[model samples]
Target chain A: MLGPGDDAAVLRAPDGRVVVTTDLLLEGRHFRRDWSSAYDIGRKAAAQNLADVAAMGADPTALVVGLGLPADLPAEWLDGLTDGFGDECALVGASVAGGDITRSEQIVLGVTALGDLGGRAPVTRSGARPGDVVAIAGRLGYAAAGLALLLAGRTGEAFQELTDAHRRPRPPYACGPGAAVLGATAMADVSDGLVQDLGHIAAAGGVRVEVDPDALEVPAELTAAAAELGEDPLRWVLTGGEDHALVASYPAGVRLPPEWRVIGRVTDGEGVQVTGRVEARGGWDHFRD
Target chain B: MLGPGDDAAVLRAPDGRVVVTTDLLLEGRHFRRDWSSAYDIGRKAAAQNLADVAAMGADPTALVVGLGLPADLPAEWLDGLTDGFGDECALVGASVAGGDITRSEQIVLGVTALGDLGGRAPVTRSGARPGDVVAIAGRLGYAAAGLALLLAGRTGEAFQELTDAHRRPRPPYACGPGAAVLGATAMADVSDGLVQDLGHIAAAGGVRVEVDPDALEVPAELTAAAAELGEDPLRWVLTGGEDHALVASYPAGVRLPPEWRVIGRVTDGEGVQVTGRVEARGGWDHFRD
Candidate 1:
């Protein structure tokens, strides 16, 4: 436990590079206060930021979180938020470094994550050359499924996992470093839906991405919930977002992490496709949604 | 010319390190729709975060801003906010790297600042040793003075300076890197007024800081405004926060930057003092008005 006090944290960029990312969460827009505790929001916030770090194929090292709350927001809520921040950081042995507090009508949290590449070249979204393999570590569409469950007025012990996923997403933080170590070609977190985010990588990497329908590992809980709502489980997996799962492209013949499953491949094309078909669909759009 | 399609941004950490900081701005608590335009609010939000980076002895390199606004928030207002963000980042050649947006009851901005140390160790608050000279860069009481003017409804052209300071503080971003290059021992942004922020450095460095009233640079404009408000101008300069000025310590005989002025000295003591007198006064506390 060396703590935060330096001019800047000294993270080990063993590959001589650090991966960085940031995300912001706002009350009402991102989550309903009735649905989650302040701790849940805090955990979700940190988890998303750390997931971005993971997407870069790096190990989470430190985080800086800034919070804005209305003057009347309860202090207990703040304490819960801090607890969540600290608790989630403890999961990865990282610490909150510094942040700023300001007044606002609602609560806003901004988190920045710093990560170490651990002697491996960063796995970037731009490196998914044609013929690369796409894989994901952690469950897909859980957050979106959870969001649907809440929207449908489902609760209690039966829907606990879905609710919990919505309130507090647990990203595969170590999987990022693992992918980097395993020489992942390109990587990103599934913040937006798998298809939408992959579109970004496809555009950036100048390669076409094709996801296979048969490869997706749809969790049984999500399948059951989808059935209850008369929704397609594959749609949840492909189109739902915010699972914060690490998705990466690996060179052919490279071994994937234990938890990761091969889902797609790269081609010398211009766009993203699923199951050999071009679908005019996306995960989440900030304004259009 | 290149954007964030890559696995990671190749930011220049000239000193082999980057100084990072973040701030979250919530609507109402930090700003009022009746008082500030979307442009002004956006600039102010970016200014506060940039000021934190400046305090770290680093050059502002990039900023990632996340916005949360209501569905009813006019598109033009969001445009104004984005323009303000772009304008401020342009001030120091920093670019907006990436960000997230969501729906909320009010506008929430989460900003992360990435800075280049330019080949110097970051000047932390704990490095101020005994006999170090304390210096300040940027305005002192202008923001407080502006706040006073706003509160009084005296919003004509006469109070433009004060109002402008309140809306968009001009932090000495370059001074952070300058201090690093000049071997500054300790540094912090004066967001909470000089006296209070000095107390932070003092506590961290285990050295008492003393300010000489005679050397204080209370802007004449503030003096005139304070007279109108029947308040003390020096009080605003000494205790008024949100100016985002950088205060640092240098070893004796070291030449200070032109933008920086010698204001006091560091000594072996328990706390911060002004003019050989101990004062219990400081800046705004979060829980209290």
Candidate 2:
């Protein structure tokens, strides 16, 4: 993989097509420096964009980062931020190919992830057919739960893991290409909550997605945190965003990878639905209150 | 030719390799609201990134824009910005492939341009050799002159072109691929003043670049503005940046393209030099005062 120091970096696209996705993270908007370390912000930025590539059923090969920061920002912070990008890319054998740096009032990171499909037909959101089984890989509400702990000033050892999840999500990198190999019909990453993201697939596929609430296995961390805070853990599971979980639709009777759990089903309709109830929409919208 | 609304965009990299470049522009730092319209800002953002691709001797195929804006920002502004992107891409027959939008305190844009080499060897900054003739393909001082007019509060029909140049630069898009076809030994775009940018090429190529100041054709606009502002016109030509002019070195005895003018030559040694004098470096540096 080519690196920075040139006008542009070159990346190999052996299959004659490249998958590209971008994400933007702003300081005080996406993350707070006082709460999350620079490393956390960088890793989160990288993970979110990389997950987009994975959702396309492609293996990420490179990332181009465009970073804007105040002039007075510390060099150490930048170093930590780049290290975070490097570590996250290393997780799935990708590299930071190139980037641009500029001065801004606050820290802003724009990451573009490039992926290779390795000749497999891309699994798109529009391909989910009626009767396809919906499955998900990776944690659902851990990041949201972690955010709640941070907001409540809960920094005890008991809440450390939850808080860390909020700071930096761990996306299931292998599940994207794995799902493709397993013949996934449609796929999307849960960056904007499970329901909202599923709605995207449903709308694109011209079908309906029904999630079985009972099938969702809530992690103990979320349950414990919800009990301590007197909040419903299921809300976080359904509406929580930033978990970067990969969810896919596979034809019925197809064997799924071990990490995926059956969560729902697709039908001939439109939008997403909870098994026996209509759920209110809850997800992050940049333009909405 | 694909557009946004997907997890990732699929671009055809027919040559099995893609060239990538990115640039980040902040509202206050890169452009002032009073000085530039949303359309101008968007077009400028696209131009700067696209110029980097052109500098690499590749044909730009697509761009991914990551925009961070305040939630209350006007919808018309966003629409205008996207139109500018579309207009700029149309100039080179490219497309805005995909992007992400998020909330931020100030408008921040991160643009990544992807280009196809089209079977040509990439002309890199490291390829210049001793005796190679240095040449330029676009305007040099218009943008810097425009900025000077804006700073001096000289806004009128007489200075409108300069002011507009400050707002939106017209990079020589065709010169990059043209230079490649003509066998340019090394190439770079003059985003950061002529001297500073050539210094990059010199450093990368491990050769000395000598500019013949007498040979630089100072445009009448720059000369008139310099006279009105009591500044040296040569300063704008030599040190003014943001022109997005393509400069390259070609081997001796090779026929130069009609649009490219011989400015100087590459020689043994290192760093950039003016034929008879040592000039102070002047260019945009994010970290420098």
Highest lDDT: give the candidate number.
2
Model 2 accuracy (lDDT, Cα): 0.88
What TM-score against the true fold does each predicted structure earn?
0.87, 0.96
Q: Model 2: clashing residue pairs?
A: none
Number of colliding residue pairs in each model: 12, 0
TM-score of 1: 0.87
Using TM-score as the measure, which candidate wins?
A: 2
Task: Encode model 1's per-residue lDDT on A1-289: one tens digit a residue.
Answer: 1135533343333344556677677667677789999889888888887777777766777788777777999999999998998888888887787776776666667787877655556677778899889998887888888899899998768878987888899898889888878888888888778888888888778788888988888889988998888988778888777778878899989976578899989999866778754453333452121
Q: Give the fraction of native contacts in model 2.
A: 0.89
lDDT by residue (B178-235, candidate 2, tens digit) is 9999999999989888888888888888888899988899888888999999998888
Instruction: Give residue B183's lDDT in candidate 2 (0 to 100).
Output: 94
Shift of residue A257 alpha carbon in model 1, Å? 4.6
TM-score of chain B of each: 0.93, 0.95
True contacts kept of each: 0.40, 0.89
